[model samples]
Target: MIEPSDGAPPDSGMTLVEVLVAMGLFGVLASILLGLGLSTQAVTEDTRDRTGVNEEARIAMERIAREVRQSAGLDSVTLPGTPAGHTSTSFTFWTDFNNDGARTNTASDPEVMTYEWDPDTEELSMTAVTGLATVTRPVLAATVTSFVVEPRSSRWQYDQVGGACSCADGITTWRELDNSAVGNYNSEPDPQELRFADLLFVSMTVEDGNGTQTYSTQIDLRNRS
Candidate 1:
């Protein structure tokens, strides 16, 4: 090393105070980045959960609609015992899977289909009859909170000259069927009138870790009209 000239200052590195300040600033920046990352992760997880619930609800509704559309007529609908009586939990109908356009019931062939909602299990199940054997399958697994099926009738009276005639028009209007109305129809004197409903309204509610979603659909019976 060479000797310094008179009144010249010595060169040196950063002091301890400067190093401490720099380290503190770096730590603060790191913490801010970490917080932002955590928040983004949380938001993504919530969106995923919500999307799952919606997808499940859509699939379930589609399955029910497809089966209902193939129904020949409504067999029966059962509601839970409640004062309000706002929900129906089970439904049975005749489905023409073979496209025969008619209901069939023989020792070797059966066409009854039933949809049941089990509150205890939070599941929706379907039962089909083939000949003398009955097979039951779970349509939707747990997480289903409610399943309701409502049937409505549409009757028309044709204008006959100057008087009204008993002829159903091709157009049909749908409405929610109540328990009392269902019971009255079931007690009809004619067995042919037991399956009188022309349209069905299917609704369901699903709940998951994210949230709850409700879906509704309308199905028209092809063979009924």
Candidate 2:
């Protein structure tokens, strides 16, 4: 028997339900791909943030160390200790941090380089003083979280009073020594003069919030100067 070809075409396509199901499948696949892309982006950003923080810390530490190592004159050096009979943390001295041969006050002329923190931005910055006077200009990276500077001196009692003893280039060990009878560098102070005794310890921490990533570096200032 010859089957009559139906004028109506045979069911040439999927049913409504089948079509809907296929669309749903495509949607699911697209969503999965999108999610993967987003994940990759997040990971990349995190890595970049971490790397940037670490690099910033290293640069800051190195710069500080270099300046300290080049510190000019005995009086130019100051430690984070009490001066003579004064027991105050506000005690600071002058140093030619830029190797300009003249001592400049922290706030005055013959300016050098200094690292200062910004309270509003929670950042640490380096500024170079221009001209013969104390003019300042920015240099290097910013966005630092915590910057702490600790200076160790020759005399434990008067670390600020007597200048860093045994101040020499290439000396690596530092010790805390006792004060002299007449307030001078004794032949053998308790803390042997090395990098650390006269050294300024600069510690900095930088971070990015999203990943809670942090970078930190500890540098001895005496070695760099």
For each candidate in turn, the TM-score is 0.67, 0.57
Instruction: Report lDDT per candidate.
Output: 0.66, 0.48
Q: Whose TM-score is greatest here?
A: 1
Model 1: how far residue 124 lies from native, Å: 1.8
Q: Which parts of model 2 are misplaced by more than 4 Å?
A: 1-12, 73-111, 138-142, 154-197, 209-225
Best by lDDT: 1
Per-residue C-alpha lDDT of model 1 across residues 62-98, encoded as one tens digit per residue: 8777877777677766656522443437778777777
Clash number for model 2? 9
Report how far residue 171 has shifted in candidate 1, in Å.
14
Lowest summed lDDT across 10 adjacent residues in model 1 is found at 156-165
